[model samples]
Target: MSSSETRPDQPVITGATRLYAIVGDPIAQAKSPAVYNALLAAAGRNAVLVPWLLSTADFDAGLRGLLRAGNVDGLVFTYPHKQAALPFADVVHSRARQVGATNALRRRLDGRWEADMFDGVGLVRALEDVGTSPGGRTIWLVGAGGAGGAIAFALAEAGASQIHLTDVEADKATGIAVSVAKAFPGVIVSLAPPSLETVSILINATPVGLSDADGLPVALDDALPASLTVVDIVPREATRLLDLARASGCRTVGGAAMVAGQAAAVLDYFGETAA
Candidate 1:
């Protein structure tokens, strides 16, 4: 047998293969194609996930085009598309509804799109990997977009004691805080400026730290305590935030850990192996 056929993770596409796509405006940077394709292959699925560079203006109609494809099984969304993708789904799952966004969309056997957000679950898993848990931990979370909202809800569900939310747009922060607080009444969720005091964990959920020119999402006045854990969802392993968090004497979790944590959960939701 050929190496591609023998290797479980190597995809061997055929006419019977199922199709999937990860859509975003700048789809080139998306990691889902590589991540999801490998997961699908390892699950013994004859499927392939590809990147779709759909423009923001074209998102709604463009997505309709994708779903119309009979062979397309599902889609993964990133950036501007996550929030926009929610309305396209026939069923908006509780996870997506609570987060105000959807990151994964699967077509039902009945031919309807079902969607949910997994970014927060990914963060929760990432936190747990380093012996940290959101439960009973006070967190200062920066960012209130789709992913930000998702993270807030996930943290709340994981039993975070308190989640202090902030965003450049104050209302966005308030939206997530309100939704999460309402959904998880036991978890204290509120909008506030990022602060180090009393918070055991700090997370940068925004894109601010993704670029070299971007300023640090939160300005720490001094070194953090050993009790505090810092996480930045920017995919770069060497983001200045991570470096600063390490230099400032605290635990640091990078974006890859979050991706690794979410991969299996995402596949489970996508349901190739389980299906």
Candidate 2:
């Protein structure tokens, strides 16, 4: 027999293949499956990443059920589940622990779970990819949830001169500001209403512009200065904020850039790396 024929078969889906899943309430809208599956294929690994549409009411039960499945080796948490998945993890990395949220989880050899947050790192990398650094820049960030909290901490770590965090729930923004300040004492972090007056970069970390019907997160009467760099984490390459920013001549970064930046790290967490 030829050497190729002598080798074991490698089908797309097999009994021995490892499985990964992204969990969220509105799982259908997630863009992780395509990106991660492509990474898995490039890595020459017999693994697949799928989406799990889990509701809040069934989150705990549904997650436990997935853990029971022998083939499920990892999970990516989104939206309402990021913070909720914390208690289930046996160990949490420093970043996730500091942010009080996790976006990725992996099964350790000892049958325990290890979790980490990558949103902030991804955002910073995305900005860096476009030749912009948060260092010494004044930033206005909207939303203070899981992704926003991570991004806020990341901006500080990137040496941002000041970070003003805003959220519909004032307390949430304040809470994140406190955590970020404690972690990076040299970085000026505060809770403030979203404004672009003195900021070099403006970021939307909320779901404010996910659909056409959604309005802009920040109100603007005229074109913003071309010096401002706008970023949105809504997963769409042409989010409304990005579109408006581009129209106004501001340099813009979309959600896809962040996803791309984080893909390598996420694959590494799954014990897989793209070739």
lDDT on C-alpha atoms for all candidate structures: 0.82, 0.85
List TM-score per model, in order: 0.91, 0.92
Off by over 4 Å in 2: 1-11, 272-275
lDDT of 2 by residue, 152-232 (tens): 999999999999898998988988999899889999887765456688999999988777798888777557878899999
Considering summed lDDT, which 10 consecutive residues are worst modelled in model 2?
A: 1-10
* Residue range with the least summed lDDT across 10 consecutive positions in model 1: 1-10
| Candidate 2 CA-lDDT value | 0.85
Q: Please write out the lDDT profile of model 1 over residues 1-275, one tens digit for every residue.
A: 23565544646889988887878766665565666767777778777888899999898888889989988877888777888899898998889988878888988878888998889989999899899988999999998998889998899889999999999899899878888888889988867664576889999988776677877886766567767799998877877788878888789998877776676777677774223
Q: How many backbone clashes does candidate 2 have?
A: 0
* Candidate 1 CA-lDDT value: 0.82
